[model samples]
Target: MNHEFMDALNEIVESKGIDKDILIDTIEQALLTAYKKNFGQAQNVEVEFNRESGDIKVYSTRQVVDESDYYDSFLEIELTEARKIDPAYEIGDIIRNEVTPRDFGRIAAQTAKQVVVQRLREAEREIVYNEFIEKESELVDGEISRATPNVVYVDLGRIEGIMTRNEKIAGEIYKEGQRIKVYVVEVRKTSKGPQIIVSRSHPGLVKRLFELEVPEIEQGIVQIKSIAREAGSRTKMAVKSIDEKIDPIGACVGQKGIRVKHIVDELGDEKIDIIKYSDDPAEFISEALSPSKVVKVEVNEEEKSALVVVPDYQLSLAIGKDGQNARLAAKLTNWKIDIKSESQYEEELANGTLYAKEEKIEEEIVEDFEADEAVDLEEVAEFEAEFAENEEIEE
Candidate 1:
C-alpha cells in the first residue's frame, strides 16, 4: 500500500504537470487536518512526513514543572519524569514526546485520497485554462459529437466545447461526427468547469481560416483590407497584394480552385466575391458590384453615399436577390448606395427632373387638363353634329 501510494503520486505529478514538491506539501497539510480531527485538542502537536519513504511522525509538547506543582492537569508534568526523557530538561522546560494517533493509517489514507483528487482537479483546470487563453479569437479543429436543439457538442480531442445556436451561421448544417473548424469566441472558467464557447458564424473565423489556408495571407504578401459577410450566404472581401507581381485574387483562389474551394466547402457553399481593393471610392465600388457593369458611379464623399447606374437588364443582378448584394457592398464600403437603371437615370436627366420628382408632377397635371379638354370637345362636337343633322332633314 505504501509503494502503491508513492507510485500514484508520481503518476499524478507527471500527468497533471504539477510539481512533485507541491503535491507533497499538500498531502502533509491534509494529513495534519486528519490528525487534528482524530486526536484530542492537545497544545503544540506537530506533524512531519518523509516524501521519499512515505514515513510520518506525530508528537506533542508539554512544560516541565516541580513535583509540588505537578497535578492532574494536562500541562503540569513532573520534572523528574520529564528529565528522564530529556536529561537536560529543567523546571519550566518543554518536552516533546512521540505520540501515535489511533487509526492513523485509515484516516491518513482517506485524507491523502481526497488531497490527490483535489490537486489533480486543480491542475487539470489550470492546464485547460492556460491552453485556451492564448487561443482566444483563433480557430480550432473539432468534431461534432452530438447536436441538441440549442447547442452543438464538439469534441476537441481532450475536451468538449459547445457551439450555441446563436453562434451558428444561417443555412450552415452541422452533422454528427463531422470534422469542422470553429472560432474560439470565449474561454471562461466557471464553477462547473472551463466553458469554451465556439462559433461558425463569426467574421473573424472566415478571416483566420483564410490566413491558415492561403500562404499569401500568411506571409503578408496579400493584405485583407475589409471583409463583409452575411454568414452562410455571401461574403465580400477586399484584398490587395503588396507585390505587383502577385495577383491577390488568383493567389487566394489557388491552383485549380483548391484553396478557396476548401473554405467554401467548410462554409456550406457560401458565395465569396474577392475584389481588388482600390484607394478611390468610385473604382472600388465599381469593382465591388461586379458582373453588374456599372454605367456610372456618382459618389458624395462628404455624405459617403453613391448613386450607381447599371443597365436595365443588370439592375436585379447588381442589387442581388432581395438587395443582398447591394446591401453587403454598402456595408463593406461603409457607404449608403442607391442603384438605378441606366434608362431610368437618363430619362430623369433628359426631362430636367431630379429623381423622378418633376416628371411625376408634370404627368399628373397633363392628365387633368386632358380630361377637362376632352369633356369640352365632346359637348361641342355633339352640338355641331345635331345642327347639321337638323339642316339636312329640313332641306
Candidate 2:
C-alpha cells in the first residue's frame, strides 16, 4: 500500500459517492480475512492501516502464562520467555507480536480490490433505493429500453423501472425507445437495487395528467371529485368548482377543448368524458351518464342510489357498448345506479315494484297484516254462531 493507491481510492470516493473512511475500513477488514486464511486461522490477529502511507500492519496476540500452566504453546507464552521482551510481563498479561507476511503486500492488494468493488456496488444500490422511495405514487416519464413477454424495462434516466403486463394498457403495445409517462405504483428495495414499479393503467395516472395540464385543478379553483377509467378505452371524471365563478367542467376542458385534447393524445386518443359534479346525487348521476339524454332522475337519498329514466330510444345509448357507459357512471357518482327507459319506468310504477329491494319488504309486511285480519274475522263469526245456538238451547 502507498500514497498513490490512496489517491486512486479518493477518486473512487468522489465518483461513487461513498465515504473514504468507510472504504478504507472495508479494505482493512478484507485484508484481515486474507491474512488469517494465508497465515494461521486460530491465532488472534489485529489489522491496522496507516492513514499517511496506506501501509497495512498485522499483529498476533498471545496471553502471558506461567511455565507450568502453558499447554497451547502458540496462544499462551510463559512469562520467562515474555520477560526478555519486557520486564513488566506478568502472568495473565497480553502481548502483541509482529507477524506480517513478507509477500503479504501483493496478497492484500488483490484482496482489497475485490472488496472495494463489491462495496461500491452495494453503495450504488443504497443510493438508488433512497432516490425512488420518495416518488411512490408520483408520475414520471421513461423510455422503453427492453421488453419481455411478462415485463417491460424502462430507462428512467438514472435507473430502470419495471412495468408488468398487468400494469400496461389493455390495447397498447410498445417498442424500444418509446417515450411514455407512467405512474410510480411502488418502490421496492431488494438485494440488487430499488425496483420501481411503473404503470400506464393506474387511475392515478389520469388524475396526475390532468393536474399537470389544468392549472385550475392545482390551484383549487376546480376539484376533481372522482374518476373511473377503463384504460385503452374510455374514462369518466366528475369535477366541481370550489369558487363559484370557475366553471369546473369548462376549466378542465380549456379553451376550445385544448387541455383535454392533450391528455387524450397522451393516452393514444382514448376518450374522456368530463362532467360537472353535483351535490345532489340525482343531478350527479344524470351528468355522469353523458352523451345520453336523461329524461328524469329519482333518487333514494338514504340508500345513495338513483333511478335514471331516459328516452325509450336512448336506453341502449345510456347503457353504452356492453354497459360500459353506465358502469363508469356508477363509479363516478359513487352510487348504485338503476337506469330505465321511460316505458320501463312506467310499467314498474303500474306494477307497484320499482325498487325491487324495498318493494319486497313492503310486500312481506302487507301479507302479515292481511293474515291477522282474516284470523280475527273467522274467530268472530264462530263466537257469534255459538252464542246464538246456546241461547236457543237455554230457551
- lDDT per model, in order? 0.86, 0.90
For all the candidates, what are their Cα RMSDs to the real structure?
A: 19.5, 12.3
Candidate 1 lDDT score at position 49: 71
- lDDT for 52 in candidate 2 is 74
**Per-residue error at 223 for model 1, in Å?**
1.9
Give lDDT tens digits, candidate 1, residues 1-395: 28778888888788778999888888888887778777866656767777876767777777889989887556667988887777988898877777866668777778888988988888888888889878899999999999877999999876788899889988677789999899999999987668899999888888998999999999999999888898889999889999999999999999999999999998989988888999999988988897678999999898798999999999999999999989888977888888999898988788776456646888989899877744677788999999999999999
**Candidate 1: residue 256 Cα off by (Å):** 4.7
Q: Name the top lDDT candidate.
A: 2
**Error of model 2, residue 205, in angstroms:** 1.8
Q: Which portions of model 1 show Cα errors greater than 4 Å? A: 1-3, 38-46, 59-100, 295-315, 336-395
**In each prediction, how many residue pairs overlap at the backbone (N, C-alpha, C within less than 3 A)?**
0, 0
- Which pairs clash inside model 2? none
